[model samples]
Target: MENRHAPDSLDSIYSIDSLRARHQQLAAQEPRLRIRERALRLGVPEAALVAAGCGVHARPLAGTAQALFRELGTLGPLMALSRNDAAVHERHGRYLDIQADGPVGLVLGPDIDLRLFFNSWKHFYAVSENGRHSLQFFDRSGEAVHKVYRTEHTDGAAWDAYVERFATEAGLPVVAEPPGAPEQAEAPDDAGALRSHWLGLTDTHDFFAMLRHFKVSRLGALRAAGADLAQPVAGDAVEAMLGAAAASGLPIMCFVANRGIVQIHTGPVKRLLRTGPWFNVLDDTFNLHLNTEAVASSWVVNKPTSDGWVTSLELYGADGELIVQFFGERKPGKPELPAWRSLMASLCAQPLAA
Candidate 1:
């Protein structure tokens, strides 16, 4: 994820021929590397790697990400993929219940859930490789925002028609700015003041506003909020919690996001696996792959909502970037599930020793 290379004209750095050659060479050397990894090695945005194949297997898509969502339902029974550096969340469902207002939007379908930030989305593409089809979106720095991949049950004709409608020319020269640095917590206000703000929270969503008002980083606020509200847990808490949920059939909410989109999964986790350093959730409709080894910190946090105290297990990378989060599956008006609270409590009931 060292996409810190200054924003530069990808076209200027590598011509189509050169990019293809370099990518090929790299791929040959590291056969298992994904396009994202190759792009990182090439010092460009991941989008640039895909862009190099434009007019061939990749077709530059026209219009904005918001506009694309309007007709997304047409491509029935698909997988919506969203990821940050450490985790990848994929859900299979029809793209239904879509809505948008200005730069914010949501896909509230039963199977596919997403919270989108269109302001961060800058490029779109219809990609076809090995007979598989996908619609990819990227941010200003060429980092992927989100991707919709076709599944076996996907409506092939609808996908074709949708692409035909939006597919445009070879595309603008692949352009990207360096991604901004990760946000770090500043020294928060006095502990008591921070606790006051934390206690005043009546809705979990309001937590962001509280941070902005007090100007503390998420972790910083947690640090100053007092141990009663937030406590450090063993990094392996993610694995332990998910495993317990699966065994007990307890439904939970998993959130994985990048700068452009937030993808959510709400239900019981039935199957789990680990390969190398990755931990995976392989269910019939939802799949989550997380780089467990990269977790730098894990926390158990409780926030007051109108319904009651809601609990969450949060994972952060070394740079203090959020990797993923989990909560009990509950609606705004419904109180937090006692079972979920118990589960989190059992996982890390005591705060880490100072």
Candidate 2:
């Protein structure tokens, strides 16, 4: 697929009216132009572009994370999409079993699992285009956090009612605020202490807290853990791992997220396609678009679970942000798959050619 590049600056600069006109014009000229890519090319955030259509194809929506999920459940089956700069994760399912605890929320459905960070979701839009329907949410930087789109199987009547109940007449387009300066995490004071903590991880859920306790970046902790725990892998490890999973019929869990929600795909990825900078999984009910070039580093990370040692392939963007993660599919009482471990070990052993 071809992606359009943005000029140095938007010719007319930004205003809700001007952006809306240009967005429509471009959409007409290049029907395949992706809004997110166009935003980057124009040096604007994606949320701003969507917001510019406030009174046109988009309507503002009111709700917190919890409220939105409750309302969305009524819409029946739909496609939930969440993405970052490097990856796009799409899954189709109903929104069920949603629970909110403070700033965090969970959608624990079988197919549409998500982890939501409400604090970052600052804007929402109920959008309609070419007979398609969707609700999109954005973060402070005008970056999309999550989106739900109506499918043919969805209840059209319920969707219309949901929008009518929540949609607001747009007045002014939302503006993206400046991204805050990144907080610098200090390096671990003692490598031994850090490695000891790493080795003591009883659950992968505790990994984040452990990183915060040590005040170190994920990569920093891995580096300090020495070769035995976190092993550096080739940058193409993602592709290799996916291929292995497909060949081995290993059901795996793939995670891709942005600031708002972590969207997961759990199953075998049968088809892998490489087109330009994108690496894709084109499968029924699930699709993944990954910008392989943006993957700066990959690691084979092992964590001890009560079931046994769990292995994962973690890919990071250039800025040290995690782009995506891959893990063998397993439940609480189940041990990690031997086939998955062997694949990871093989990938680790074969370093990329210099």
Winner by TM-score: 1
Residue pairs with backbone overlap in model 2: 6-41
Cα lDDT of model 1 by residue, 190-255, tens digit = 768878877878899899888877777788887777677888888789999999899989999999
Every model: Cα RMSD to truth:
2.7, 4.5
Model 1: ten consecutive residues of lowest lDDT: 1-10
Clashes of each: 2, 1
- Model 2 agreement with the true structure over 1-354: per-residue lDDT tens digits: 111223345455466667777676676777676777677655567767776762237888876656877777778899999998899999999888887757888888998999988887788888887778899888876778898999999999999998888877762355556555444463677889987887887898889888888888887887777766788889888888888888878999999977678998888889889999999998878899999999888998888767788888999887788899998887888988888887888887643111
CA lDDT for candidate 1: 0.84
Clashing pairs in 1: 7-177, 7-178
